[model samples]
Target: MFSRAERKGLRLAGGLTLGFVLCFAGVAAAVLLGHAESGDGGPLLDPYLVRVARFTLWQAALSTLLSVALAIPVARALARQRRFFGRVWLLRLAVVPLGLPALVAALGIVEIWGRQGIVNDLLHLAGLDNPVSVYGLAGILIAHVFFNLPLAARLMLAALDRIAPEHWLTAANLGMRGPALFRLVEWPAIRRVAPGIAGLVFMLCATSFTIVLTLGGGPAATTIEVAIYQALRFDFDPPRAVLLAALQILMTAALLGLIALIGRPDEEGATAGRPIRRFDGRHRRLSDGAILFLFAAFTGAPLIATLTAGLSADLGRLALDPLLHRALATSLAIAFASASLCLLLALPVVMTPRLADRGGTDATTRFLARALPATGSLILLVPPIIIATGWFLILRHFGDTTRHAPAIVAIINALMALPFVVRVLEPAFRTHLARTGRLALSLGVTGANRLLRIDLPALRKPLAMAFAFAMALSLGDLGAIAIFGADGFVTLPWLLFSRMASYRTADAAGIALLLGFLCLLLTLPSASAEPETKGRGNA
Candidate 1:
């Protein structure tokens, strides 16, 4: 029997389509406002914009090179190592940065690597000055590598896990060791996924704003996003801001284009990769053991420090402040709301193009539609400060900033996190639909029932995971909140910043730890929900 929801597919579809329309409307309105403010001509390019663009790309390239080059040993070690002391703990620890806020991570880095930090303290004890400059390209690189290497290692480890046991066995039988085995097995697999991992990580570093701002400390160290913020906040240069926005679009698009060339396909016919024998050589054993410790320390120490700082923070005093409490409340609300909003906005974009035709999705069109999220991801290209500045100007011109208020911040955060929502959900969505598509059709399954009965159960895991990731992304965001969050619309990170500036280090660290835990809590259900792929068995 057809469920009530199945009968109502048309209505649900319409509502979903409407939501997408509204979401896209906000994007359109923002651009139009920006364009009108710039005058009759298009966004004009200037010398400053050129300089910012060059620095942004240069730093991103350098960071990418360092991150990937460094990740090689870490990834290989994780892949080769199967059992060791706290190895699993190390692997999990490395993923912390992915969910941690950029600002929070920056705080930890400053505490650890700053002039009065451990490194400098040791240097001072040695009879040398604090020669380490933690505020330029070097500082930026340190933070990027810190965050990106663990991630690259994970991706590489996953890639490395796919080697066939037969290949290893045959190599052992043929007395193939060292270089020959690597070329036959390791090389092929790493070659396949390396570009994708590098592209993703590189693009991530390329567009990063918060790390650049906190660690940059100077004009030349600034990225396009940071520069856009400067053009708006410091110089009030609208034209330059717009120019940087356009530049971000161009560069990020080029990066994503490269990603397309290397990423694995996700079509219906795609199967789980064939499995390979897990490595068991003595050399491999030692490599895995060292990898465990290296990645663990690289990823874990900062977190341990942050958590320690947080737990020891004077939260008893901090919470006594009304503003801190208010900011905490606001951050929590926006994080959840933004995540939900992104999911709603993506449904139509994902489902509509397929439902309208019903002849199974056209691969090219589907991929193109998938690109919508990435394209909209350009919001991240322009810093929240820049985006807020533009909107602030546009709103002020209309004689009202109060009217937009928290809604503006919420929308921007939602859109900024939209790409991740779409990307994470696309595969599971397709899988669920493909598995049940024809079955649901003949049964006349339609609306919420169809979604719940056929779609939800099948997609329950991925859907839940997508939501968690979106929430985590939103929670870590610093963009829109930096500007729009003023006047009582503050977020946790904003509050932490205010406290740290006032020398309330204990409070800031406490809030940072709290924020970290909250993100972890949000991430759990989504992750545990997804089933393992074929080649993912313990190596």
Candidate 2:
């Protein structure tokens, strides 16, 4: 549909994006490998490293099991009770925790389970001697479940929601109820999604940094991500950090290989779709109610606690704190830059293929088109911390590292958001081009004129929504910043983490509240725009 010049520009832009990904990513990988070969002068598998790896794997496995285990019944309950009051809102609520900053959730968990928090207060009133501590392995499990259970449940619920209405009718007509109904109908739907959801939850828990860092009371509970941070920041041990990053990359690659072998579930058959009419769960209202109540309490407590704790702090004084303002400004700047960069890179990458198909059909163009989108997933294997670590080493080789913190953090955060951005925008762009590309070209609408008059106007909603989601994700990010954050380079999460570390509970609460509020504000626009498009495990 494009004129020759426009298609050429698109191809050029796509090539540049591909080059950007390859050049820097290639350099980062090479640096890490070279460092790994040189060694840290310490034994490769010392007792501490072995212990940390064991704990990391153990916690991830346990967290995955608990999250998926609990999510099954909750998802089943949601699918069964389709017409209940607040059902829509309950599903919306589940998405909130997923978008929320990890530090905020960790703070919320602490408010409910910490030594001087609500549970302890209740125990003291009841004459109990020991207070429940949210400061070790137990705390880690709780935090991981709080973040991942909703994710697993939402994914499973989507699968269950897609079950053909005729299947339910068949089960009901057969007088199938309870275990028999599940065995025949529901189990198959849940089973299809369960493994993929489990793998995602496991990876999330495995790479967990802020949650573990906040809740890991000491070395006894530390994960590899946190250990890497300590190695670089505390011990000033770049060699050790490089080693940990290498180990993490290898571990992640192996897990990804396993998931690839297991493969994704086939897409459900086309059906006469509508809201599920689960007739068999009629005899199980009491049991389903109990299940839902437990799920709500388990998930809702942290949210309620986060708000109550944050509001209980002195708002006036907290607002006036200069450091808070500075962090807020820094975070906003970074988030805005990251979101813009994400779109800038994503738009050309997505556009190149459509432009290519219209103008040319060469093997090189086809290969470039296919490969550009997959570049977004590269971050999965080499996460933000490792990227930051690699860049940290590179900067150290040149000069001061702290000076480049904001730019590096923004770039990494943008890359981290790239996959989601591509998912949201690619479909919108494809549809828009299919509908209007020919008509616009017929009218000689091309180049700057077309983009301003046709493309921007037509694509405003998805663009805005994509921008908001990317900004929210960047605003709450702690991984890249944790590696590069310093006294003058603090963001909201880094500042809150520092406060919590220094025993400033009240200050930390206020920061958490502020950060949470900002993230929520950014999330609303995206959620409203494309609610159905989410919870597909794209994040």
Best by TM-score: 2
Poorly placed runs, candidate 1 (over 4 Å): 1-46, 126-128, 262-280, 284-288, 356-389, 400-403, 524-539
In TM-score terms, candidate 1 sits at 0.85
**Which ranges in model 2 have alpha carbons more than 4 Å from their true place?**
37-42, 123-128, 273-275, 355-360, 397-399, 528-537
User: Cα miss at 510, model 2 (Å)?
Assistant: 0.7
Relative to the true structure, how large is the alpha-carbon lDDT of every model?
0.68, 0.85
| Model 2 per-residue lDDT at 193 | 79
- Tens digits of lDDT, candidate 1, 172-251: 77887678877876777777766777787788888788888778988878788887677766786666666666677678
Clash number by candidate, in order = 12, 0
